[model samples]
Target: METKKGNFSNDNTMESIQKLTEQDAKTFLNLIYAILKDNEIPSEKLISQVLSVYEKKIPRLVKARQDNN
Candidate 1:
């Protein structure tokens, strides 16, 4: 199921977070691309960093999302 208020999805996923507004997903993607290019990092390196980040942030994110719901 989905919720169409603005651009956000009610489901639990990164896509849902990105869908917070119509421009959210695009902005998130552009920001990631810009960071990768600016730091000269490979996609794999970015994935590694993302994993490291997820480890630290997923719990907080989950809580935040649940609170929002």
Candidate 2:
């Protein structure tokens, strides 16, 4: 399977809020909100943090899903 990387825009963020079914997305959003609330930082750094977490989680999440099946 070819995995396509998603490009998220400000508009796409709103769409994701409506469309994402996976729990990880919800957890990530919560973490982002917490990070924003806890610190005053540039938006670039905040986005980088969220992307880093998502990258770290993907392999582990795929493995867990395969195990369950």
Candidate 3:
């Protein structure tokens, strides 16, 4: 993911979801969770954020993997 002028979108932020691999996804989630644990308290928003992060990380968890792995 290429960082833009402070915004995280478009060609900015992380690369498109298709670019992420399984280990990459797991690492991404771990990093986010680590940050959440260090800076934020447990809350619904936190949970939601975690889920959202997971949504990006493990796409298969949300949708069927066409590769059928």
Q: Highest TM-score: which candidate?
A: 2
Each model's number of backbone clashes?
Answer: 0, 0, 1
Query: Looking at candidate 2, what is the lDDT of residue 66?
Result: 58
TM-score for candidate 1, please give it: 0.37
Candidate with the larger TM-score of 2 and 3 = 2
lDDT of 1 by residue, 1-69 (tens): 223532223244464454345464465556556656666677788776554333323434545756898
Q: 54, model 1: CA deviation in Å?
A: 8.3
The pairs that clash in candidate 2 are none
TM-score per prediction, in order, is 0.37, 0.42, 0.39
Those runs of model 1 whose alpha carbons end farther than 4 Å from true positions after fitting are 1-11, 14-18, 42-44, 50-69
Provide the clash count, candidate 1: 0
- lDDT score, candidate 3: 0.55
Q: Judged by lDDT against the true structure, how good is candidate 2?
A: 0.58
lDDT of each: 0.50, 0.58, 0.55
